[model samples]
Target: MGSYDAFCKLYSKGLLFTKPIPLKDGSHSMRNIIDQLKDSLSRALTIFYPLTGHLVTKKGDDAPSYHVILDCTDAPGAQFAHAVVDAQVADIIAPDDVPPIVESFFPFVGTVNNDGHTLPLLAVQVTELVDGIFVGCSINHVVADGNSFWHFFNTWSEISRTTFRNNSNSEFVPRPPIVKRWFLNGQGPIINLPFTHHDEFIERYLPSPQRERFFHFSPESVACLKEKANAECNTSKISSFQALAAVVWRSITRARQLADEQITHCWLPVDNRLRLDPPLTADYFGNCIQALNATTTAGELLSNNLGWSASLLHQAVAGHTDASIRAWLEAWVRTPFVYQYGQFVDHQSVMFGSSPRFDMYGNDFGWGRPLASRSGNGNKFDGKVTLYPGREGGGSIDLEVCLPHQPMKALELDPEFMIAASPSQAF
Candidate 1:
């Protein structure tokens, strides 16, 4: 097996990390919080493996792993002495502006913080306080999925709690690396495409029109939506994942209709950890297994009932013996086809549901659980959906909608699209 250092290049290539805040209050100390996070990260750093990458722009590879820096926003700091300031700065206290880590990995990479998804990926701003602390980090998806990242974060919290007293056991035993069962020639998924004469597939996937963001729902609200959906579809038992899938599928379809588009597509990233015998440990890094796919056309999708639509989605992703999904993902990841074909998907959305509930509630970093948790907006996908465990026993889903301003307005008018909480408008 290749050494952990072999995986460092891959880990650095894949963006995997998150911005977490303790609370929204303004009394927390940035130094203490950073120290805790630094310790937590250091304990888990070995598991993350060698941080490898070369900055081709300057022809140098020596640099510290990404650091936390504070960017000044209009939000207030400390006492309520200043004017009604509302700017927010990064929780990380850095001396000055730093180039993005991604830039070092991929030359000619775009740089700018615009929409919700891309914003976090580029740079995160933190607001420090006693009631709560804000963190901003753009975690790339190539290294570890939500599961891997959570596994490490939880360990950090667990160890941090007792570190002051004694060296807690934050054992990060290296998990067996994913076997290179496929040919070394395999290029991975194909994501690049040529649209029209000038537009590229990647651009279409990350449309400039839609602003990416994570929208969260309370446990009660999620249960209510799922209950209503279940009642509507009596034959088959549906999950909150399916319910949200139905809603988003329906919503996207409706948006397409208003936009005067008929043909559409959607992709779901399938996890193949369990599909393998002696399933990959929670620590397994790199791309394990995935399947990128499209649903029925918009015309048919819109005409069908929610239950029917959900059933179709369920059927598309069900069943697995060996890496059936992995085989598909390998084909895409190994090739440049995804880059070419994605442009043809006039209306496409990527959705993930049924995420582990343990990721959120269990991630207590000393100051109790986070008051709120939401999904990160990514510029790579048009629409993104993530589901977390609700308070009761069901599931809650966060959705980020990206579309033209007119379609967004129409979405607001619909009864199903309830405004949960506004980012800029509400505190």
Candidate 2:
């Protein structure tokens, strides 16, 4: 787990998935769905057993350091809660901004990942709405990244759908996770941290208050961004994701109204699954990601066109080869640093996580596809952006943008940004 040691102080990643229910079935339908999900989750954990475990620290023999490890000997199960909300589906999906009530759907809002030692690494809350259902999942960041998180979710839904359709009493998993943790050649399964106590390490960690809004980009809009960027650059090297990220970076920087000379950064979490020497399997069940930074002065970024910013992002991502990834790992092993909240307080920056390429709309547990998707109130900060595949599918993308109240209001009014974004009600 050396690769994920830095994420220990961060908050658990939380996601909320909602779908409408038929009105005729009433309470019985809700009860049946909850029961089925619980049973299927129980079976899923047998394969993803580490999620049900707790993190423990041990003293290193040679150095005055602590090593964190998952302890599943007691088989402490994951938390599952069922709650009933008075509101209907329209109350949540109708708002232009993500409603405050959406955060309540999740199990852990402000809990940090280090709390996994005492709390369940994974906690799920099934909030029953008047005319819909919201399934909220909070998974410890140290245990899994977005890929692994969705892998477990997809498998759980598959199990539930299979059982519902077949009405059989057999355990089956469509895709099993690769639980073997990967490490550098000289690295160990025992990852040592410089901190002696968890409290002292994370005592200063505090999340800033922010407002989150969803922006939907249709397939045509995405294509336009890519086309315009490529035409400006006089090359077709800029990918759609790069072009989209470029627009977001420029728009937010403009909304923040930073000084022309100010240094701004855009950090992206690059997946290392396929970028390693011997590439790990796609289903490798852990955090195998590195934060890659692209930087420029505010003046340069704002003065340039979208293609310029897109090219910068493309270069940063393309340069993260296998050798560079290993070098980063080796450097971390020498001096382990646990990333805390507000790590970028000194800079005007943006951080991107949760890719749109994941199978966001495919988690159908015998019901129809999801009507919408949302995130919990954990790990949120100004300038944090999470991308999801649009519910409409195709090449469409949805961005969940978080920022301070004033900047968020300004961003909503920015014409350049609004031209590419669909109205919030479209989802």
The number of the candidate with the highest TM-score is: 2
TM-score of 1: 0.61
How high is each candidate's TM-score? 0.61, 0.94
Q: List the RMSD of every prediction in angstroms.
A: 11.2, 2.3
At residue 321, what lDDT does model 2 achieve?
A: 98
lDDT of 1 at 213: 37
lDDT of 1 by residue, 1-427 (tens): 1101111111111111223443465322445556665665555444443211111111123331111111223212111110111222232112111112222223112422111111222122333433345433333333344555555455555565555234455463334333222222343222222122221122322335453334456556655656767776674466656566666667755754533345555556566666665565545554454544556766677776766666666666665445565455455443423222243334455455326344555555555555344333333334444454532334544444555555556555555545432222112
- C-alpha lDDT score of every prediction, in listed order: 0.42, 0.81
lDDT of 2 by residue, 130-218 (tens): 77788888888888888899898888888888886677657766678999878898578887777667765664345577788889999
Maximum-lDDT candidate: 2
Q: Please give the lDDT score at residue 13 for candidate 1.
A: 16
